[model samples]
Target: MAIQTIIVGTGRHIPAVIVPNSAFMHHQFHGPDHQPIDKPNEEILEQFEAITGIHERRYAPDDLLTSDMAFLAAEDALASSGIDRESLDGLIVAHNFGNVRPNAHRSDLVPSLAARVKARLGIRNPGAVAFDLVFGCPGWLQGVIQTDCMIRAGAARRVLVMGADTLSRVSDPHDRDSLIYADGAGAVILEGREGEPGEGILAHAARSDTFEHSTMLLMGPSYRDSAFLEAFFLKMEGRKLYRYALHHVAGAVKDCLDKAGVDLRTVAKVLIHQANLKMDEAILEALCRLAGLEGAPPGLMPMTISWLGNSSVATIPTMLDLILKGDLEGHAIRPGDTVVFASVGAGMNINAVVYRFPRS
Candidate 1:
């Protein structure tokens, strides 16, 4: 029997605090020298909203850590799947930074985050492995890809793939790049099931641009301000990132669909990484154009960035849970539908997975 990786359940954990764009109004902005550089707040916001389409986002309290968020999300996913944790075969965690504090730029690097979350879940199976995957923004999706291979290889029957990040802790609150991030976690339970046509992960494609790997996404050295210290803050070449996604990400999505022998019209939804709203819209337009789609259909590409901002690997899965569970008002998923998951970031890697929704 061919093993198919089917998503049995999904869950997410978002911080309690809701930060509107206005919250940054009076907050001090700083330059590389770490000195305060005050800009017209309203003008900054106008440009921000116009480009990113994000008005608000959630933030983990200074005390909250990446593993903490992952544990919360993992619990929800385990509960939703109704799967016994001890009986699980694998637990794979995806993340960039482990856990950081509000004033701390360095993430705790002692014990692996997967170990911490697995222990928190109280799973006791020597045979059930727990580990971490560091694959930049495509982290969680890469975890899923590995889980699929494991299931097919008979190394696991069930696996938990979770992506969590606390970019809020590492971000320089005053940086525009920091404005693009938030803290959150999303988890999916993948079970080895009988291969049912169009009812599991159908096809996928991945690519890495190694030449552009000069820390296009990077954290800087310690800052004079504790808030800015360490390699804590993230900086990026927005224009380059945008160009790569537009030129490559859409093509990757199209490739995955083609590999599945499906048409763009057959995909029920296109969930690309929630990096920027404007950039996402641009990618979708090019994607549709590549697929020969006429004016990309509405609601086919669900977005959570306007409210959630970007949580790195957590963005896609969290949005998937929100939409599938009907928590996301404008988007939806029905049984038997196929959804395309795609992302590009950090490692300059791009990947797309074609997933088929299952009917109960």
Candidate 2:
């Protein structure tokens, strides 16, 4: 039997505060020049919805911090896995921004979010190391990959990995891109299990292209001139980032599938990052083309962006939790199913993983 890192439980915490596109109608939109956009608000939002497929998104209440969301999701995972908190060998948390106060203009990260979550989970094992990962939007999947390596290397038997972010707290109200951000938390427990070949994690791949595209997704002052000039909000070179993802993200997914020696037709699902509907569609088409297919099979990809918006690192894991819990209609992963997870984000980074559900 081969030791494989397998997902034993999953959970997510989606905030109850819903922010719809109409909420932005009264706000003045600005371009990169800090000048007013010429388009009318209705036309702008209509096009935004058509492109991004985000009609609404959730926001954490002002009372909850990023660590709070992570802790909630972690508790859910622990309950689902029925794993003892003290038995966890490692705890990893992923996020781009630290704890950002809903009413303040600053972010905090003095004590790592993982440490805070460890305390909240009541995991008193000093040997159960806690740390954080900051790999952009691919952070959660990257955390999963790292946990796999640790288990495979005999450094850990069970690990808890989580991705949570409150992007709404850091978004610029004046920028159109701000409408694309949301907040949520998702987590999964991975444990080393002895299983036959072709189970659990099979292969993974990652890439970083910072030399030329480092600024594609970054932080800058508010798009509105002279407004909170001292504070920075999440910013992006929209077209550049879109083009970069289209050109590279598909290749990364294809590389992982090839390394796993799995054919595209055998894949049950491709859970790519939910950045934009159109961008993800194009990446799937490109991945199929790389495999000598004309296009992706119908229903091969499941998306939640239309309703959940983009929650950065939390998107994929949250989606996974929903599907596994029968909350996401029309999707299910059965035993022995092959699934591929991929994401692209800040750091100009990209990663893909091939996994097979364990056959009990």
Candidate 3:
């Protein structure tokens, strides 16, 4: 019997602080003497907003940690889905940083978050187990695969898939890449159930070009050479990464669709990782060409990068939340639609999944 994982609910939580791009210019570009830089926050915000279509982004309060954001999103998802917390069988979080002590195993953050959720919701079940995956932007996709497998194996029936990160905390304020990173969380409830053929998670494909792993990296405090941390904070060979992601993600998307026996023409929309506006456009073009979808009508390309910037693993679900909020209301996506979820992240990892919306 083939097991199916259906998206029962989705939610996202952005922080209360709406940090406009101008805020970055004001704090980061100032001279050592506290003098204003030539470019004001308004000008920077205008440029970024125009290019990325993001006006502002929310940031976690100073005292709040990434796990808090994760719980926030989980609460929203459970409420919106009307799923009782007590019924949840497992929790899977994709996070790059945790509240745990340095050098401690990263998986420890899972139980900590699980405890908070259980306490807040007053749901105590021994089945509640938490685990963390640190795969940068591809973390959430990896979580989806793991959760799907677990549900299929009967290890879990209801799985909470969460992607949360506080990249800004580890970022270099002086770097543009750091300025673009923000903090937030997004989540979805994947329940074990069978969907009609060509629905739910039809197929998934992943690939990694290990030689390009260094293209994006984060060195932790445990490293003896603290200097590496200076370079590790969201550093990227932008051009190199853009080229690689376009080529690889495009291929992965097509491969997944092919394996699912679906044609590109049947794809209603492509929900890609909101890495950047330029990279997105390039990947869109490449996917069209590879799928022989040229001259096809334009598809939905909702982006959260302008405001949320690069949220690592949280980008996909956050964008999905934005979609649910009518961000692409005029777009052609509808029930029974075939969509592609694709991402390429820091590990030089590429993953793509094909799903069909349930018919209303």
* Winning model by TM-score: 2
* Candidate 1 lDDT tens digits, 232-322: 5777778778887888888888888999888888888998889999999999999889998777887899989999999999998899888
Compute the lDDT of residue 281 as modeled in candidate 2: 95
User: Against the hidden true structure, what lDDT does model 2 obtain?
Assistant: 0.92
Clashing residue pairs in candidate 1, if any?
A: 222-230, 223-229
> How displaced is residue 89 in candidate 2, in Å?
0.5
Worst 10 residues of 3 by lDDT: 219-228
Question: Each model's RMSD to truth, in Å?
Answer: 2.0, 0.9, 4.7
Ranking by lDDT: 2, 1, 3
TM-score of each: 0.95, 0.98, 0.85
lDDT of each: 0.86, 0.92, 0.73
Which residue runs of candidate 2 sit more than 4 Å off their true CA positions? Answer: none
When summed lDDT is taken over every stretch of 10 residues in candidate 1, the lowest stretch is 221-230
Which runs of model 3 end up more than 4 angstroms from their true locations? 26-55, 100-119, 220-232, 325-333
